[model samples]
Target: MTLSNSRFLFSAAGLALASLLPEQAAIAQSAAPATITVQVNKPGGAIPKNMYGLFFEDINFAADGGLYPELVKNKSFETDDHLIGWKAVKGAAGLESYIVSSDRPISATNNHFLRLSAKAGGADAGFVNEGFRGMGVKQNAEYTFSVYARRGPGSVSGMTVTLEETRRPGPGPETPPSGQALAQAQITGLTNEWKKYTVVLKPSATAARARLKLTLDGAGTADIDVVSLFPKDTWMNRENGLRPDIVQLLKDMKPGFLRFPGGCIVEGITLDNRYQWKETIGDVAARKPIINRWNKEFKHRYTPDYYQSFGLGFFEYFQLSEDIGAEPLPILNVGMACQFNSAELAPISAAKGPNAAGQGDEPTLETFIQDALDLIEFANGPATSTWGAKRVAMGHPAPFNLKMIGIGNEQWGPQYLERYEPFSKAVKAKYPNIQLVSSVGPSPDGDLFDKATFKMRELKAEFIDEHYYAKPEWFRQNASRYDKYPRSGPKIFAGEYAAQSVAIASPDNKNSWDCAISEAAFMTGLERNSDVVGMASYAPMLAHVDAWQWTPNMIWFDNLNVYGTVNYYVQLLFSQNKGTSMLPVQLPGNAKNGADNLFTSAVTDAPTGDVIVKLVNYSTTPRAVKVNLAGAKKVGKTGRALVMACDDLSVQNSIQEPKKLAPKEGQFAVSGSTVNYTLAPNSFTVLRIPAKK
Candidate 1:
C-alpha cells in the first residue's frame, strides 16, 4: 500500500479501536509481541555529517544574560535609553551623572559614555548597575573588571568598584544593599587621555543577586565607558567569553553544525535594523549594539531593555563553532524584512538593472546581494581582500572555511522567491562550492510552503529549510511527512522545530515528557530519511527562567544554574548516537505510522561495527519487542541500552530537579540472533549492540 493510504488505514483502525473500550484498547494493542527485523549488513545511505545540531537565536536573553557572560548590561551606554540598567546611588550627596555623546567617540559605532560629577568631599557619588537579573558569582571565583576611563575635571584620585549582594524584601521591592562586599577593586591611575584599566577580584562569598557599585574616591568627575565584569573561568578561558557551564551543555551534545546569530534576528523588525555582519566584527566596543528583535515580540512578555551587545558577534560564533568541532552555518537576510512583522521590501528592478530606481538613499537589492558576497569574502577570502583583511585584523588570519549559507529564515511567498533567486544565483556564480539553503516559510504545510518549495525546486536550490512548531499529537501523527518527498528535489534542513505542549509561543507551553517523546518519534523519521533530510535542529536553544520571552526552550537557565529539559536529552541521544550509515529495519504487521505507539529506526556505525536501534514507545503499557538481527556473522551477547522514561507524561525537569527525567543506562543480553527487549511505556530507548568479528 502507498504510504498515505497506509497512514489513513492506520488512523481509521486506531479510531475504530478506540471506540470499543478505552482501557482495554491499550491492553489489546500490547497483547501481541511485535517483531522487528534488522538488516545489519545492508546499509541504505551515508548519513550527513551535520545531521543534528543547534539553532541559536538571540531570544530569551540567551546571548546577553545567559551565554555571553557579560555581567554588566548597557556597558557602553549606547542604547536610546542610555541609563536603562544603571541607577544613581540614593545617599550619594552632591553627585550627578549623565550620558555624554561624542562626535569624536571611542569608536564610530559606540558614541556614548557615562559621565559622573561630584563636589568636594562627595566621596560616595557613583552608580550601581543591576546585572541581568542579578549577577551570578561563585565563592572564591575571580572576576575580571575593566573600564575605559579618562580624567574629566576637578581633582579625582581614583575609583572604587565593589560587588555587593542585594536583598529583596518579600515580593514587594528590593531592599538596600548589605554591608558585606563580595569583591572589591581600586583603579588609581587617572590620565587626560582615554585608557582601559583592568583589575581582578576574588569574591569571598557566592551570591546569585549580586550588584556592581562604582564610587568616586577623592571627589572629581571621571568619564567611563564599557564598564564590564566577567568570570575569569570562561569557556576556553578567553577574555570576554561565554559562560563555561552553558557551553559545557552544548559541548556534551556533540552537535554536528552550529547555526548562529538567530532565527528572526536575521530578518529584523525592519529592513534598516537587520543584522549587519560588518557591524558585528572588529573590536567588541566598536561592534554596534541594537535592540533585539525579540525585545517586545510578545505583548505579555515584553522586555524593552533587551538588546544585542554584539559582543558575541560573528567572530565569536565562528570561534565557538571551531571550538565545539561543528560546522558553522550562518543565515543572512535576503533584503527582505520579517514577513510576520514589517514585511518591508528592498527596491529591485530586473529590467532596469541592479541599482535602477533605487529607493532614495535606502539600500537596494544589489546592496543586500553585495552584503552576501562580502560575507563570503569575510569568511573565506584571502588576507589581501578587503573584508578578509578586516577578518585578519580581528585576530584570525585563517579563513573560517564556511561551507553553506542560508538565504532566509522561515520566509515565504513570491517576494521571498524574488529575493532568494538573485541571492542564490549571485552566491553560486561567485562561489560555486558554497551550498545555499532556501526556506519554505514557518509552517510545515501551507500554500506559501508549496509555492516556496515549487520555486526552490525550479531554481534547483541545494537545500530547503523547513520549520514546524506543532502540538505533540501533530508531531506523532506527522512523523512520516517526508516519506513522500521527491528524491530528486532540493535537500531538507529541518532548521527550526519544537513540539509545543500547549500552543505555539504560548506562555503555558512546557518542555514536558509528552512533547519530548513525540519529538523523538518524529526524529526517527528524520533519521530514517537522512538522505533527504541533511540537517535538523531544535528552535530557541536557550532560555532564561526569570527573563524568558519564549516557552519550551531546549535549555533553561537562571542566574546561577541551568538545566536541560526532556527535549534536550532526546536531542542529545539522537545526536550523540548518529551513526555513519542508515540501515533498513523491517516490521511485519506493524503500522509504519506508529499507530501501535511504537516507532523505531536503525543505523549502523561503520567505524565501530555496531548496530544502533532507536525505539520510542508512546503507549501507557510496556511493550515486548522481539528483534531479529539478520545478515550478521556473530552478534555480541552484551549490549547497552539507554532509556529515558518518566512516570508521568507532564513531569518536567527544573533547576532544583534537573535529573528528574534524565536517561538511565542498563546492560542487556542478546541471545543468539533473537533479542527480546521490554520497552518502557512513554519512553525513548537506544540499544547499541556490537558485531563480533
Candidate 2:
C-alpha cells in the first residue's frame, strides 16, 4: 500500500500486475523474480550507536546567516570591511557622516565601533542594516534588538531603532528602507561609558526583506557596536540561539553524532586564519571575525562579504550537539593550512624549526596538540579544571561528554603523517581512552589516499577518515566499496561524502533525486560493514538559497524558511531506521550488491523487536520484492514502510515546495514470515516488521 511513482495494475488472474512490455515480458518469462532474504536470527555484528550523523561546516552561509539566527550580518563591525552590512541613511537636512572608529571602544578585541554624527534629529537621519539577504520577520513575532553604545561628544541622548521594509533600488546605489516601519523601539538612556542596551520590537506585519534602521534622537554623535537583531523565538528559547526550524530538521534525523566546525574551515587558507577552538569558546562579542575560507574560493559564485563572526562558536557547537542529542565530534586544525590553499604548515616543534621556509609566526605542532588536550578538558574535564571552569561559567556545568576528535580534515602525504604521529601520541598519552580520527586525504580512492590510509594503519590509528565527492553513477557502482576492507585494522570513518549531480564543486551541482537514491544504495555497504565502518555523515549539511557558494547540500533554506532536499529524506530514512544489530542479507542469483539495479541491507532493532530492511530500486520500473525474514518467531501480520520515490531523477525540493520529494509512510500485510512489497521505480524504501527471535 506504499504510494510512489511506479505502480502495478492488478489483473483478474492475480498472476501478474499487468501485461508487461515486450522486453519486460521476455525477461520475466526467461528468469524468476528477484528475491531477498533477511537472516533475522543471524545478526552479524553490533551497529555503532553513532554510525549515521551530520557533518556541519560554515560554508554557504550555514552558520552566521543560516543557522546562528543572528539576522545582522556584520553585527560587531569587525570584518575587514567594517561597514559590510551597514550603510548611512541621510535625511533631507541632517545626518553628516558615519565612520567606523576604534578610539576608547567597547573592548580591545571588539575594537571597531560605528560613530554616527548628525547636524539634527529626524526619522531619516539614521543608518540602515541590510540584514543577511534582508531580515526575515514574522507578523507579531517579537525580535530582540541589542547594541553596545556610548555618547560620543554630542547631544544624542537616545537612539531610535526601526524594523522597516527595504526598497529595491537600481544597482550601485545603497538599498534604502521603504519608510514603512514593521516594528519600532526606542532606547532613551545614553551613558558616557560603553554599555550594552536591549529592546524588543514586535512587527505588526511580516516582512521577509526588512531592514533595521537606527537613527539618532538628538543632533549629536554616538558610538555603537555589536548591534544584533535576533528573533525572540529560537530553539529552546535561549538567547543567541539557533534557528528552530533548521535545528528541528537535524534533530528529526536522530543522528548518532554531530561532527562540527568544519571540513576545510578547520584548515584555513593560511596558518594564521586556521580555526582556533579556544578563540571560538569565550564571550560571543569578544570573538573576532575572520574571512571565511570559502569566500571567493569559486570564481563563479564569488562572495566577497563572507566572514565568520564566531557567534556560533565552539561553545555553541557543543551546546547544539547536546541539544540535538548527538556526540560532539570536533575536528581540529593539524598545524597545517588547506592543501588546496597556500599550503602553509606549522613546525612540528620550535626546536625542530619551521617545516617550510617563509612561514610566519606559526604555532608549533605542540600548540595544536595542547589545543586538542585543552578541548577535551573544556568538553569533559572537572569544574576545578581551567577549561572546565570556563565551560561552567558559560552555563554548562556538566561535561558535554565528548568522545572522539578528528585530527586533520583532508590532509595527506608525509606532512600529515609526521604531524599526525606526534599529535595522536600526545592525545593518547594524556587521555588514553579517547579515540582519534585521522585523515586519508580528500579523494576517496587514489595512490596518495591509499598511501595515507596505509600509513594510518601503520600508526595504529583508531579511525581512518575517508572523503568522497563523485558522480551518481559512481555511488551506485561503488555500493560495495567497503566490502573488501579488512575487519581487523583501524576502523573506517566515511567522514564526508555526497553524490554530485554534476562535476564535484561545480556551480551547476544539484541535490537531485538520482543522487539521493544512489547515496542510499552506497550506504548499504557502510551498513553491511558496520563492524569496520564505524561512522559516516554527509558533507556541507546546509546552504542558503540566495547566498550559497556550494551546491548538492542536504538542506536548503532562505532567510525565512528551511527545507530538506531529496537527499535529506534519503539520509533521514537511513538514520532514523538504523537498527541495533546488523542482519545478513542474501540477494537472488548470488549476485553482488547493486545487481540488476537493486540494492538492499537489513538489520534488527532489539529494543523494538522489529526486523528492519532497506531496499533501493534505481531502475525506472516497479520491482516486486519478496523479503523472507528467516528464523523469526511471532512475525506480525502487518508491517510499516517509509518510501521516497520519483519518476524523474532531476526533481528537487525547494523552499516553496519543501516536501515535493519527501518520504511517504504506509503499511503492508505480512504473510507468516514473508513480506512481499513492490518498490516504486527510482525509490528508496525502509520496511519495519514486528518480529521476535
Candidate 3:
C-alpha cells in the first residue's frame, strides 16, 4: 500500500493504543478535538495571483549544463584556458592544436578559436569534446550539429563528426553499445573564409553517456569555433533553446512569476564583472561571454571552466517567462558590487570644475542609472525608441510588458541604499507604473538586514526582498514571521529561500523530507498573511548531479533524466492550489498557532467556489481533527485530498527513485458541515471541497 493509504488505515490502531493508556485516553478525550473552524462565508483578503513562483540563479551549473541545453561545454573556446572542455583524440599525436586569438574576431566580444595543424597521412588527427556530463542521446532522435570553420595554410579535406557512447561496460546478459557510434555526419565543404556548417544526425540507438568527435580527414590547418550540438526538440521548437524537460517542469508548476538571471550574479565580484544587460542582448555571436561568478565561490567545489555564454540572456528570459505564462522579473545591478567580494563602488564626483559631476569619467553612477532606464525602455518602451528598436530587431517587436523590476540582488548597508536610492528614484520617475523590488541583503537576522529594512520603510518602498537559508527548525519557528509586521510598511517577497538540511552551503545538504515538511509548515504562514506578502519562491531552482556547487535545490537532473525534489512537490502543491481569496481558519485553545506542531490555512477559489484547506502535521503521532465548515451554506459530500507523506524525514528522492516522496491523491467524504480526517504525522495534506450554491 502507498504511504498515504497506510497512514489512513493505521489511524484505528493509533486510537486503540491511546485507549490502552488511561493518561493518554484522558488527554485525547480532553484535547477539545482539535477543532478547525473555517469561516467560509466571509473572505478576509485577496491573495496575490503571483504568490508562489520561481527564483532562478546561475549557480550550481544551473544555466550551462542544467537548463540552457547546449551539449558542448566550451562552444566558443572563450574560457581562460581556451581548450578546457576539448581534448586531443587518441592516436592523433601527429596533430598539433592551440588557441588562435584575433584582433578582429567573428565578433569583437569573442576572440578565440581552435587552430588544428595536421601532417600528411594523419587521418586520425582531430579533437574530442566531452559534453556536460556526456551528451544524452535517444534512439531515432534527431540532433543538429554545427561548426564554424575556416581553412588555413595547407590544403585540407572535410571533417567528420560522430556521436558515440564512451561509458565502461558492465555485467549484463545483453551486450552494451559502449564503444559504438550512435550518430555520424560529415561536412565536405571548407573554404578559405569562415563559414558555419550544419548537419542533422539521427541516433540509431539510445545511450546515456556519449561524446562528440570531430576528425579532420586530410592534411592541413583548420580554424574551428563555436562548435554546438542540440536536440531538435527544444522547448517550443525554437533554435538556440532551453531543455524541454526542465522548461516543462516549470510550466507544469503553473508558476505565477519567473525571477531571472540572478542571485549574486547581478552583483558580481567587482564592478567590471557585473551582469550588464546590454551585453547579453543582440546577436548571440556578438554577446560577450564572462566567467561565472560562481566559478570559484567555494574553494571546496571549485569549477574553473564555469562561464556564462549569455545564450540564455535577458531577451530569452523574457521569452521564456512569456512561454511559461509567468511574469518576467529582471533584476539589474545597482552600482555597487557584491559585498562579500570586492565591494567596488562606481565613481561619484563632488568636484566643481570641468571635471565636475564626473562627466568625463568613463563609467560613473550616472551611466549606471542610464543602464537601468535603458533596460526599462528595452522591456516596455515603444518599438520606435532606440532600446526598444533593438528589442524589435531581436524578433520581439511587441514589448515584454514588464510591470516589475528588481534594483539589486541581496545587497545591503549604507553603501547599497546610497546607490539604490538614486537608481530607484530614476526608474520610478521615468516609469512610474513599474513596481520596484528592493533587497535586504544576505540574511534576515543581521544588522545589515535591520538597517536595510529601516531605510526601505523610511523610503516607503513598494516591495522588500528578503532571503534566508536556515535550518528546518528555524522555518518551523518562523511560520509567523510576518504576522506582526505593520500592514502599512513595504510588502514582502520571500525571494530566495530553501531549508538547508545541513548548514548553509554545506556539500552534505540533501533535499530531505525534514526540510520540505518544515518549509510546508512555514508556507502556511505565508499563505495566512497573504495581504503583507506579495510573492515567494524557492531558490537555486535547478542543479546538475555531476556539476553542482550548491545543494538542496528545487529540481535535480542528470544528462538523461530530471526529477523534482520533495521540496519541489511542496512548492508545487501550494502553487497549483493557490486560491483566489483567504478565509479565516481558527484552531481551539492551546492548539492555536501551531502549538502542537499542526499548522493550517484556508482559502476559497472564486471561480470554482471550492474551499481549499492546507494542513501540515509536524508531530510524530497522528492527530485526528474535526474540520468544521462553519458559516458554509452547504458542504459537498465528496472532496479530494492530496497527501505528501513519508515514513522517515531523512529519506530523499534521487534520480533512480524519483517518486519516492511524490504526492498521492485520494478521495474523502464530508458530511453537511463537518469532516473528520486523520492527518498523518510528518505530512502535508490539502483538502478541496465544493461549496453548494
Candidate 4:
C-alpha cells in the first residue's frame, strides 16, 4: 500500500486504531520504527509490471518449538535427577535401587536420578539409564551431569551428596574465596551393587554457574550418567508465559496457515513416546515429559523430562492459529516411527490398552488406520470422537475443526519411502476431504528429495511438500524451485524452505541477512506457478540460537524475547501484501546477484481502477526503475507505496531491538504516462497506485 511522504492522515480505520494505541504504546516502541519509501507509476518504455503474491506455510501459528505453558507464574513441577538429596528404597518393587523426592520436587528431567554401587558394584538405586558416564561440574545454569557410586548400607543415614568450593588439598592456597554448601543431603542406602546417579545441579551463587564439578564422595561406589545444561527457556512454556515476542513474529508475518507438534518432535521412537496429543495438553505439571535427541550443552545430560503440561495442545494450536489469522496444518504419527529398529523403540502397548505397547511385534499394519480416524475427529468430530472426546475432557469440547492434515515430514530416504505408501493410501480412503502433504527436497549429501517426489506422485500423494534450502542468490535466480515440473498427481506445498549451506553450516539461511528478501523475490516465481503449487511453509521455524539444532532458519527467539532475522521481513512483506491473482512481469535489465536482483510482477485492483506493482531489488547497488504506465493512463491518478526493506543486509530485529524492513510511503511524480524512482538494494518494494476515478 502506498501513501505520500506527508504525515499519515487518519482514515476512519486509523482513527479507530489510534483510540486503542494508548494501550499499545509499548508495542509501537517495539516495531522497527524506521521507514523506507515506495514509489509507483504507469508502465511505459522502461517500466515493468506484474502481480505479486506470497506462498503460505501453516506451521502451527508459525510455532515449531519451545515448551509454552497455559498460565503465567504457573511453574510446571519437574525433577531432574541431578539433585540427589535423600530417599528411601522401601523394597525391590516400589523404590527399587533408590527413591528420590518425586512428589515435591517433580519427577522429570535427567538430573533427578540416584546412584549407588556399594554391594554389587553396579547401580542398585535409581531408574535405569544409558549412554556416557562420568562426574564433572562447574557449569552454567541448567546443566547436565552424571554420578557413580556403590549402594550404601543401613536405613536413613550413612552417606550423602556434597558439593564444595575448595580446590584440592596442598594446592598452594588454591581455595575459592567463598564457600557455599551446595547440598549435604544423605544417601541412606543398601546392597553391594553398582549404581549410577544423575541430576540437574541447582546452583546458589553466580560463581556456581561457572564452577560446577561432579564428584562421588558419599558412602558408595557409583556409576554415572552424562551431565549437561539445558538451553534457556528449557522446556514447554505456558500461556502468559508464551513469549509474547514470539507471538508477534507470527502476527507480523501474517501467515495464512500453520502446522504443529512437528519436525522430528513427531514420529518419535514409539507410539507411547511419540508427540502424544494427550501429554502435550493442559496444565504443564500434569503432562509427562521426554528426552530431546538434540542434546544441549550446559545440561550435563539433555533430557527434557517435564510433563508436557500440553497447554498448547490441539485446541491451543488451533486457537493460536485463529488468533493470528492463519489456517492450521497439523501432522500426526503415520505409525512407521522415527527409529528404524524395533528394539530401539519405547514400549507403549502396555500404557494404553491391549496392544498399546505393541506387545506382539512392530505396530500392526492396521495401526495406520487409527490416524485417519483421528483426523476426522480433530476436524469434524462433534465432541464425540474418541480423540474429540479427549479434547473436550481437556476443557474445549469443540474439536479443533481443522482440515489440513499432513502425512509426514522430510521422509525422503529409503526408510521414508518404504513406510509412506501405507499411510497415504489409508488416509486417502478414510478422509478424502482433508488435503494430504508429503516431503520432497533438493539433493544435498544426506538430503535427497527428487527421488522422494517421484515416489510421492507414484503413490498419488495429493501434494508433495517441496523443500529447498539454498543460498540467497539461488532463491532469486532459481525462481522455479520446481517450475514447469511435471507431477503425475500431487500438487506442490513448498513445505520446508530456507537458504542452507550444504557444504558448511550456515549461521542464517545461506548466511544471508537478505535471505528473506531473496525469498520474497523468488516467491514471485512460486505465485506465478501457484496453479501447480497449492501450499507451503518454512521449516525449523523457531530457534534459541543458543539451543539451535539447525541454522539458517526463519525465526529465532529466547526465553523472554524473540527476534526476526533478516529473512523474516521478506516473509512479512509478501504474505501481508499479496494479490488474489497473479500478473506476469519481466526484468529486462537482468539485475546482478541473482537473489539480490530486481524481479517484477503486477496486479490491478480493477474495482478501484488502482494498479499495484511489486519490484524486488536484490542488488548491493541502487537502481532506477522506470515506470511506463502507458496502459494505466485511464485509471492513473496519484501514486503511493508501502515498502519493506532494511538498512544493512545483516541488520536483524529482536524483541529487545527490532529492525523493520517494511515499505513506507515514497514520493513519485506522474508525467502523463511515465514515472521513475530509485529503489534501494536488497529490498522488496510494493507500490499501489490510486484510481483516476
Candidate 5:
C-alpha cells in the first residue's frame, strides 16, 4: 500500500495535482515528478442504516385548536375530554359554544381540555370549527379522525358531527360541500360532568380538497376538548405543512443536520417565561402562546406563535425528524435567562418586580430538572413511562430515539455562561446517552457562545451551533470558513444557515445568484468536514407570507400555493449526492493571480472504489476545470457524472413555476486521472467516478 505526495493548484475549472513525491510505477505510471497513488478497494464493512435525517419544524399541532381528534368525517356529534361547564349561547353572530379549558382535568399548567357542545348541522343550522392547519393537511389527502369529548345537559337524541370544507369566507349550508360526515347519539342526558367519546369517518368518493371540519348539528350542546386528525401523508406538524414543492426542495438539499427552534428562538426569556416544554405540549387552546422577541422587527404589534402547544411536542419533533429522514436536534430551556433586560431588568428581577411574574424569579431548579427528564422520557422513554404513556395515548407509541438534545437556544454573557455550565453539566450527567448541543452567537434572544474552539471546549460543549444569514455569495465564500477551524472535541452544527431573513434579511438585497453560489460554497465546506460537522439544518425552514418573520426561507407558502426559493436548490444538490467515507482530497489552489473563481474537493469511498468530486463555480461566466486523479492510484477509462446546474443564479422556482431549479444530469468525459468539463457560474455540480485497477 502506498500514499501520494501532491500539491494542487486550482483555478476556474482546472485541476493541477502536482505530485510532491517520487513517482512509483508499481502503483501507477504517472508522468510528473510529483508521484501519486490512488488505492481503491471494494465495498467494505456495513454502512449506517441511516444516511440522512430530515423533517419540518412543527408546532402546528399544539397550535391547532387542540390535539384532540378533530371530529372530521365522524358518525356523531362528540366532544373531547372537556365535557362540562360549557354553555351554548344564541348570539347575533350565531350559535357559538364557549370553549373554556378551566375544568378539573382541563386546568392550565398541564392537564387541560376545552369545554364545548356538539350538535348536528340540521340542514339550516351548524357549527363551524376553525382550522387546525398543519403537516400538509392543507393539501388533499386521506385522513383519520378521533376525539375525547362527552355530552352535556340537554343533548340531541340523534346528533351527528358532519365534516365540511369551506374557504375562509365560506359558503352557506345545503349548497355547502360534504367533505365527510359522522353522526352519533344518546343525547339529552348527563349532569354536570365529563365523559370521553370517539368517532371514525370514511371519506365518500365526493371528498376532495379542504381542511378538517367538525360540524355539530340537530340542536343541543356538549362540552368538548382535545381533538386530533391523522393524514396518511403530510408535514410533521401544521406549522410547516409548507407545500411539497418546498419540501422536495429541502429533500434535494443534502444538509447534514438541522439546528432549529430558531436563528432567534435562542433569545431566552426570563426563567418563568422561558420556552417551557410543558406548555409547548398538547391542545393549542390549552397552550398559551407567547410573543416572539422578533415581533418588533415586523414593524407591527405581531405576536409570535412560539408559545406552541407542543401537541407536536418533543415526541412529535422526533417523529417529524424520522418522517423527513432528518436527525432531530431541538433546543430545550436551560435556566439562564437571555432577553432584553435594560431599565426594565429591575422590575423583572429573578424574584421581585413586574417581570418577576414570569421570570423575575427562575423556576425551582427541581422543575428545570424534571422538564429535562420529561424531554428525554418523551424521546426514548418506554411507552409506559410518564411522558411516554402520554405519547402512547397520543397515538405514536414508539419512541423517537432522539439522539441530539440542545440545551439553551442562545445564552451568553458571564451570567448566562455561569448558568449555562450547570445546565450543560446537568444535561450531560442526566442523559449521558444523548449528545448535548450548545448555542453560540447573539441570536435574537442572547446566548451565543464564542467563535474560538477553545472557549467552546472550555465549556465542555459537545457541539457548537453556527448560524449565517447573509447574501448568497457570502454563503459561497464563507462555506470554506470552517475548513481552517482548528479544534477537536465539540463538533460544528450549521443549525440556522440561511441567505435571507424577513426583517433581518432582505430578498431584494441579495440577488438570487448570491444565494445560490454562497449557499453552494458554504455547503461544500460542511460536506467536506462532515467528519467534524455532525450535522446541519436550515433555519426558517418555512415562511408564511402572512405569517413570515424571516425572508428567503428554505420553503415558503401562502395558503394553498407554495414555492422554493433559489437558495433551496443548494441544499437539494448536496443532500441528494452526499457520499459516505469522505475521501481526503486536496483541491488545487486558487486561480491565476490568486482569483478565487472556483472551488473544488473530492471524496472517495475507498471500499466501493467510488470517487466523487464536487465543483463549485461562482463566476458569472462558465469555466472549465479538470479533476486530477493522478494521485488516485486507480483510474478507469470512463465513468458517469451528475450535475445540478441552472443557466441563471437569480432565477427562482415559484408555485406557478416549478422545475425551474431542479437538477438535470449528464455524462462528461473522464480520461486518466482527470475528468474535465465546463461549470456554469453560480452553480453546484457533483461528479462520480470508479476506482481504477
Candidate 6:
C-alpha cells in the first residue's frame, strides 16, 4: 500500500479494535519508528554570515535602567517633570527649597539644573534620589559618584553624598530614606565655575534598594547638573559604559550582527520626538533627552516618568557591537512617523535636495537622505571627513565598518513606497556599497504586506524586513513560510518576531516554554531557507522586571541581576550552532516541515567538520528516530546532544531560578552512519556528529 493509504488503514484498524474492546482495557499498538536522512555530500547553499542576530529597541527601560548602568534616572534634570526621581528630605525643616533652574546652564541643549537654597547646613537639609526601582549595590563594591556643581552666593562650602537603604512604613504617608548609611563621601571644593566633581564610595553592606542623598555642609545655595552615580566595574571598565553582566550575556551569544537604536522609537509619537542620531552622540551629559515613545503608548502599563536620556546612543551602540565582535547595523528614520500613531510624512519633491534644505528648516525627503549619507560617513569615513571628525573627537579614530542600514521601522502602504523610492536611490547614488533593508507592514500576511513585498521586488531592494507577533500555533504551522519564496528578489530579514504565549502585546503574555519551542520549530524553516532568509532576530531584546511595559522579552533583568528567558536559550542555541552550509534533510514521505509534530533541519559546520542537526519534537510522548547521514566517508563513533525539555508549557524562568529550564548536554553513541536517538517529550534538541564526506 501507498504511504497515505497504509496510514489510513492503520488508523481504521485501530478505531475498529478500540470499538471492540472495553474503554479502560484497550491497549494500543506501537507505530513504525521515524527516520531522517541527511544528504551530507550535497551542501546546497552558503549560509549568510550575519544570519542570526539581535534587534534592540529602547522599550521596557532596556537602555536607561536596564543596560545603561547610570544609577540616576534624570541625571541632568532634563525630563518634562524635572523632579521625577528627586524628593525633598522628609523631616528637613532646615532646608528651604529646591527648584530646576536653567540660568547660565552647562550647555544650550542641557538647560535644566537643580538649584538648592539651604536655610541651614546639616544631615537633614538635603534631597533624596530614588534610583531606577532603587539601586542594586553590592558589598565591598566601589561606586563612582560624579556631579556638575557650582556654588552660588552663599556660605555653603561643600556637599555630603551618602548611599543608604530605603525603609518602608506601615500604612501612612512616610519617609523613604533609611538613616543607616552603606557608603559616604564628601565633595569639599565648590567653585563658582561649573566643574565636575568625582569621588568613590565603597559600600559596607550590600543593598538591593539603596537610595542616594545629597546634603549641604554650610548654609548656602548650590547648582547641580548631570548628577550621576555609576558602578566602578562596568563593561570593559570604561566611563559611561554598559552593565557588565548584561553585556557579558550578549557577548556570550556570539550574535552575527547588532541592529540598533530602535523599533518604534525610530518613528516617534510625532516627527519632533523621533530618535535623532546626531543628538545622541558627543558628551554623554550633553546628549539631549527626550520622552520615550513607549512612555505612554500602552495604557495598561503606563509609565509617565519614562524618558530617553540618550546616554546610550549611536556611539555607544557602535562601540558595543565592536566589543561583542558583531557587525553594526543601524536603522534610521525615513522622515515618516509611525503609521499606528500620527502617520506623518515629510514633503517629497524634486526641488528638495542638499542645497534647498537648511539645517534649521522643516525636514523634507532630502533631509532624511542627507542624514543617511552623513551616517554612513560617520560610521565608515576617514578621520579627515566632516562627520568622521566627530567620530575621531569621540575617541574612536577607526571606522565602525557599518555594512547594512534599515530605512524604516514596521511601515507600509503607498506612502512608504513613494518615500523609499527616492531615499534608496539617493543613498545608492552616494554610497552604493552599503546595502539597504526596506520595511513592510507589521503583520506578516495581508494585502498591504503582499503588495509592499511585490513593490520591493520591483524596486530591486537588497532586503525586505517582515515582522510578526502571533500565537504559538501560528509559529508551528508557518514553519515552511519561506520554502516557496522567489530566489531572485530581495533577501528576507525576519526583523522583529516572537511567539506570544497569550496574544500579541497582551499584558498577560509570557516567555513560556511553549512559545520558545514554537520559535525553535519556526527557526528550522529559517535555517532551511538560508538562501533567501539572510537575517533574523528576536524582538524587544531586554526587559527590566520592575519597570517593564512589554512581555515575552528574550532577556529579563532587574536592578542588579539578569536572567535569560526560555526563548533566550533557544536563540542562543541556534546562533551558536548556525553552520556554514545547508545540508538537505529528508523526512518520512518527503515532508517539508512540521509533520507528525516533528520539525527537522540540518547544516554542516565547515570549521568543525561536523554535521549539525536541529530537531523539535512537539508531541507529549517520547519519539524514537534514526538519523541516517547518507553519503558520509567517515563518521565519529561518539556524538553530542544538547537538549532542553520541559513537561509544563507554562513554566518560566525568574531571577531566583534562572537555569531551571536551560540546556543540558549528553553523549550518544553513533553506530556506523546511522545514529538512533529517542527525543524526549516536548523538547528541542541539537545533535552534533563529527563527520566528513
Give one digit per residue, the lDDT tens place, for model 4 in 235-262: 2333223435567667777677777767
Off-target runs (Cα >4 Å) in candidate 3 are 1-32, 90-93, 121-123, 168-178, 350-362
Models sorted by lDDT, best on top? 2, 6, 1, 3, 5, 4
Error of model 1, residue 363, in angstroms: 0.6
Reference-based lDDT, each prediction = 0.83, 0.87, 0.82, 0.48, 0.49, 0.86
Candidate 1 per-residue C-alpha lDDT over 1-693 given as tens digits, one digit per residue, 9 for 90 to 100: 000101111121112233224554576455666889888768889989999999999999999998899999999998878887887753436465555667355766778888887774242577778899888899999989999988877887779899988874323132235446888989988887789999997889888889898878766688888999988999989986898899999989999999988789999998767898888888887776888989898999999999999999998998889888889999998878899999888777532333223444667788778988999899998999999998899888999999998898888888888878878888889999999888889888878888888888988989999998999998889888877888787999999889998899999999999999999999999998898999999998999999999998999999899999989999999999999988888876646847677888989887888889999989876666777778876788777777786648998889988878887766677777767776766779898888632
Model 1 clash number: 0
Model 3, position 60, has a per-residue lDDT of 82
Worst 10 residues of 6 by lDDT: 1-10
Candidate 6 lDDT tens digits, 1-693: 000101111121112233222421132234455889999989989989999999999999999998998888898988889988887763445578888998999999889999888888877678778888888899999899999999998898989999988877423243454657999999988989899999998999988889899988888899998999999889999988899999988988899999998799999987777888999999888988899989898899999888999889999999999999888989988888888888877778644323222444567788788988999999999999999999999999999998889998898999999999999999999888999999988989889998999999999999999998999999999999999999778999999999987888999999999999999999999999999999999998999999898988999999878999889999999999999999999998897689988999999999999999999989766566789999886899877777787768877888998877887776677888888766666889898889998
- Name the lDDT value of residue 573 in candidate 3: 96
TM-score of 3: 0.92
Worst 10 residues of 2 by lDDT: 8-17
- If scored against the real structure, what TM-score would every candidate get? 0.92, 0.95, 0.92, 0.63, 0.72, 0.94
Q: Which residue pairs come into collision in candidate 1?
A: none
TM-score of 4: 0.63
TM-score-wise, the better of 2 and 6 is 2
Q: Which candidate ranks first by TM-score, i.e. highest?
A: 2
Give stretches of model 1 more than 4 Å off: 1-30, 97-99, 121-123, 169-179, 350-360
